[model samples]
Target chain A: MSVDAATVRRIAHLARIAVADHEIEHLRGEINNMLAFVEQLNEVNVDGVEPTASVEDMKLKMRDDVVSDGNYAKRVLANAPATDDGFFQVPKVVE
Target chain B: MNAPVRNPKLLKGDKHDWQVVIGMEIHAQVTSNAKLFSGASTEFGGEPNSHVSLVDAAMPGMLPVINKKCVEQAVKTGLGLKAKINKKSVFDRKNYFYPDLPQGYQISQFKHPVVGEGIVTVDMQDGSSFEVGIERLHLEQDAGKSLHDQHPSMSYVDLNRSGVALMEIVSKPDLRSAEEAKAYVTKLRTILRYLGTCDGDMEKGNLRADVNVSVRKPGDPLGTRCEIKNVNSIRFIGQAIEVEARRQIDILEDGGKIDQETRLFDAAKGETRSMRSKEEAHDYRYFPDPDLLPLEFDDAFIAKLKADLPELPDEKKARFVKDFGLSPYDAGVLIAERETAAFFEEVASGRDPKAAANFMINEFFGRLNKEDKTIEQSPISAEQARHDRRSDRRWHDLRQDRQRPLRNRLGRGWRPARGGREAWHEAGDRHRRHRKGRRRYHREEPGQG
Candidate 1:
């Protein structure tokens, strides 16, 4: 699949990334080249093969339902830009 | 009784009668000790951020491990609904942006859900029943809570609920009225409670629903549906569907088409307003997650879970009708809650089942409601009720003979049993004397003067 300028703009907007009007064409071309390189796999005739999420044929690992980790509120909120009373604070968002 | 020729809930429009179609998406928090993919506590009402693990906080290089209990719970719920449990299921990342979502994308099932289509038989208040088709059941992680009224310029974020496992059960558009929708939720909650998968506590937001409603002519094609999101109570769900359907009918009657969008139910104002238009809605690009492998299980695993299943509401109701010789309505009311059904069974054992049902439903339940207490909080236990039943029978026989008055039958200075009618009458007299706003039943001891 090839990417166009309009598609690039829409993608940028959906990702909440800002892009300049002139940079859309360059980004579009770069995306198209990457897609073309990945599209070479389409030439293979691999019908009836089950699509898999991981290359490794391994089962999903599971853990017992126990509370083994938590209660380090200080460390949890250490990287937050803002906090108040053990809670992360952000600009009001109501919808 | 004969089936009605038409549904009584059809709305009369200016030129024609309109029928409302509804579907529900219920999100029930899985009852587990830890979160779905992290080892963090899932207890409600903890200190903010105290339940957050590194994985839940989305720290760099933090990996997610599936919780075995959560998957088992989802399977148990699927079995309870008589749904198809897929041997293999995949979890996908639903891409979106929200302040409460620290991961920016929620891990959910999109194309391949864990449970497949099933049917829930919903019994209406009028003794009629309808089957609501289950589309699918998928597992997903819950987002953090955002409290908007916490501060003047900032909102407080609580991640205690983040990463909690939720089973999103979607139903087909088969509900024709608001009452059916309410009954459907009620029945689903009972089933989940029976399976012990979810607590079904709406007060703590453990269960919530998103209702999709549309209005169409009696025999026309389906109309555009507007989704009312995050309705917490069954009563509000009914009101929201009615209000949204009326709004659509009015618009269509005026030659204006309904705009499909997500709306919010303003319970205080009793109306639904648009939250976001269809054009501005988020396009959730879902894809399989690379961090986790596909969930695969064998038939033996499903068989083990199914064998451990408890008797569900429908089965219990049927048993009550056939074995206990109870009317369908009485059986339905008794088995609505697991505890109530157990209480009834305990009292009915080795006794007249019909009489026991009548006393429990008419007398015990009535008094419980008057005092605003549940079966667990009853002043009298089932054993006490059984003991009292004997004395009550004797009193009935004495009154039936008509040869002597009750006072004379119980000769002078001959005290009745502990919970006999005489003691109850004395307690009632005391209650009237001390009617100073006490809520409990005041009973005197057997030997007390």
Candidate 2:
């Protein structure tokens, strides 16, 4: 799990982000620092203690299971770069 | 229009007992109107960045105020799975840079996942059931979607989904087959739907699965699981597993070592492509999020959640069987989706559970299947179903056979469905209500009148 500089560089490439060489060292440092903090979490005895996923305790306000809104096709695609037949257009991916 | 779906199983040669080690990370979008930690509307379709708040956009001065409802939903999900609720937990910063993530780091539950060990039981067609163990369920915030090819060069980001609440339910490497995995996800989705925590819409990216697939020689230590990224549909996940497993088997069989890496399943290409080396939890450099403090709650609060929890799918399915006298399959199908289950219960209670089940499973649900319509979109009301039972002469004959008015008792009980299946039948046929049966009783068959 120790993210080395080369791994950082590879991750950037795979994630499609352009990272300068000097920044790789900075990324390495940041990753290592984060790992150090995570390492501290292991000291706590969580053998049987359940982990908390959600922070609060309130019910999600239930809505009547009714379809209320449907006439928003134009609104939905208003910012689309390209669209056709009420659907967003993309480079043909399947063909 | 349908495209030819190339089956991967065909190309997968030989039924070798390669230990297929599979794990899953399922992300379910919490059914909430607002974002997880912000008041911004979480509506699906909105203008680009319209739903983005200062907090969601990662503004320097912005702060996150947790949505209490989201937490409750998470707890409800945990409780529904019969998992323990934690008294205290912390949100950590999973730092990774992605254009879609306005904040350089995603706020997620890491070391202390909210829920711990649980089990999901899947019924096989052979009247047997298998139990799959759940490792953990963690919470996180969703990132925006980056739309490439929107223009020749410029990629657009839709913040409508950014900062939405998510529960990442992780499963143990217990599955050995595609069918089992499918059943696991199906059951998990059912439990969530029953709890009213997630909308469970895979097409809209509300629910997605990350499949960890690997192959090992039998009795080999757990193989290195290569995580297949972001399969949005269940069918696609199954297909990805088959393709990835076979690809690995082909490599190992030919003396190639399996590389532990993250791979992407290009559904369009019908293949998996190596993306990069899989990153460990440390690679993200997770730290206690400075913006938020560790979440702490009392047992009383958890008890309240436990108290208010809806009858989970399994319990409800069993209740349908024990109380309503429904077939296990019918009960299972009805409870798989929450609303469908509710609609079935509405139709069944007071009416003969068997007759109501027949109409729901056969008459209403069957017709919907024939027309490729969803139950939510169906025009049928429970009222019309009851009316059909009362008025249809064939139903009356069945009632005579039973020596009692089953439809009458049901109508007397829940008046709406008592009107009968005519209204639902009318939904599929624009003119059926005006043309169909008027007698109050009939046998459950065609041409029985």
Candidate 3:
């Protein structure tokens, strides 16, 4: 949609992005371009046409309900920002 | 539609043909020991830069070494999706600039994906079934996560997600409503979970979707759609589609225009805002990596995969409905999550199926959710496992901590409290008599006893 300058600023604030005032003009173009592309779908006769999500008609295969997990204590702990003897270290809960 | 779609049902508040044309691109984390291109551990929640290998970090001298396991996983995921598994697939660079992307471009599959043409039929809570089309399932490496919450001054980057194998499952737009979109994503996640290919945890960022949405009149053409990027949860996807569709309809009917760009979903306000313009595949200038060769698989291997294929969710759901005499809807719910479905079978088989299904769905799941635990963490037992967790844990340790102890001793045959009152009284009497005998023996020989 033709979102206004103020609306663009409001949206940027909502999305928590740092957008400059000059960037607002750029965003307007970018957003306009995107909408134009999606609008192309309007040209196709989709009255009875169903929008497809996937291309096939099958279900997902499954394993025997099992509990498979990692046990590499060292491996799991290897990338910890901070570690104790065998655990990830966090700030102590108690004073 | 908030727009001028002349649907009688919508007038009556049905929005039925509020037909949500939902399509999804589900990014599922592939289960593997290493990343797609490097030997870095494919794990979740690691410190920044730790899980990153030379290739992931885009080292000057580094070369891409395709992880065969990741490739196999992509093929396996394809097989599970009933898609055409392409043995000959090439990796291309999805050119994009993100702070989290160490390589500045994602190593993704373009024209040649490992899996092609799969379909998911989401049986809604209602009796109707909606078929969502699967376009292609490709292999790619995940970018790092940007942790914005921890600090206002600095955005921390966690590369633990970097190089992790991901199967980007793209779908054809077949959804007719926001509910259908949610259901489609839910079903897709269930399938992925069933295959044991992904953990399918959206909150943990293991699985996510980039939602493409639009609106059109029933007989008129499709409207210019907007792409809502990287929505992490199904509920949010549904919300985003609804908001976006309404916005498009409003704009079109109001003589305004819909902008085609990557938008962000504000779950708090239930709206989508523009993020950036969507880029074409050509914009990325996709080209095959010279460092890796196109993989080719033999027929024997494919046959092996087919033979080794486990009972999928549909089969299991149908079987649960048939063998266990559970309702189709109940079976679907039971089988929606893989571990829960397994727990249901272990509890249902050779026991009261109705009771088992009820407990698995109601009590077990309720408690687990209350405790904020996953089905993978559920402490429920499988009926077939002869020994308990101790023995299985030993086996896992012996297997070098790969296999897991897959059960808790919520042993079958524990009759419901209300139904087995007589049996409970009888057992109590017997236990009391045994205790009396023990007391007598202790009085006769206290120290010896």
Best by lDDT: 1
Best by TM-score: 1
Q: Indicate the DockQ of the complex predicted as candidate 1.
A: 0.77
| Tens digits of lDDT, candidate 3, B1-449 | 11223222221112324334556788888888777777677666654456666666665687766766666677777887788888666677776556567576788888788788877777776756756668999988888766554543445555667778889999887777776777777777777777788878777878888988876666556657777888887767777888887777666666778777778888888888876434432256576755555656777768876777778888998888888788887788777766667766775555567655655554444434433345564333344222222332232233222133312322232333333434334544555565533222101111110
Q: What is model 3's DockQ versus the real complex?
A: 0.03
- Candidates in order have lDDT scores of 0.83, 0.69, 0.64
Total clashes in model 2, counting residue pairs 3 or more apart in sequence or in different chains: 34
Given candidate 1, what's the lDDT at residue B449? 8
Model 2 lDDT per residue over B30-96, tens place: 9887888777777897666666666776766887777777787888888887777776677888987
Model 3 Cα shift for residue B88 (angstroms): 1.1
CA lDDT, candidate 2, residue B65: 75
Ranked by lDDT, top first: 1, 2, 3
The C-alpha TM-scores of every prediction are 0.89, 0.74, 0.67
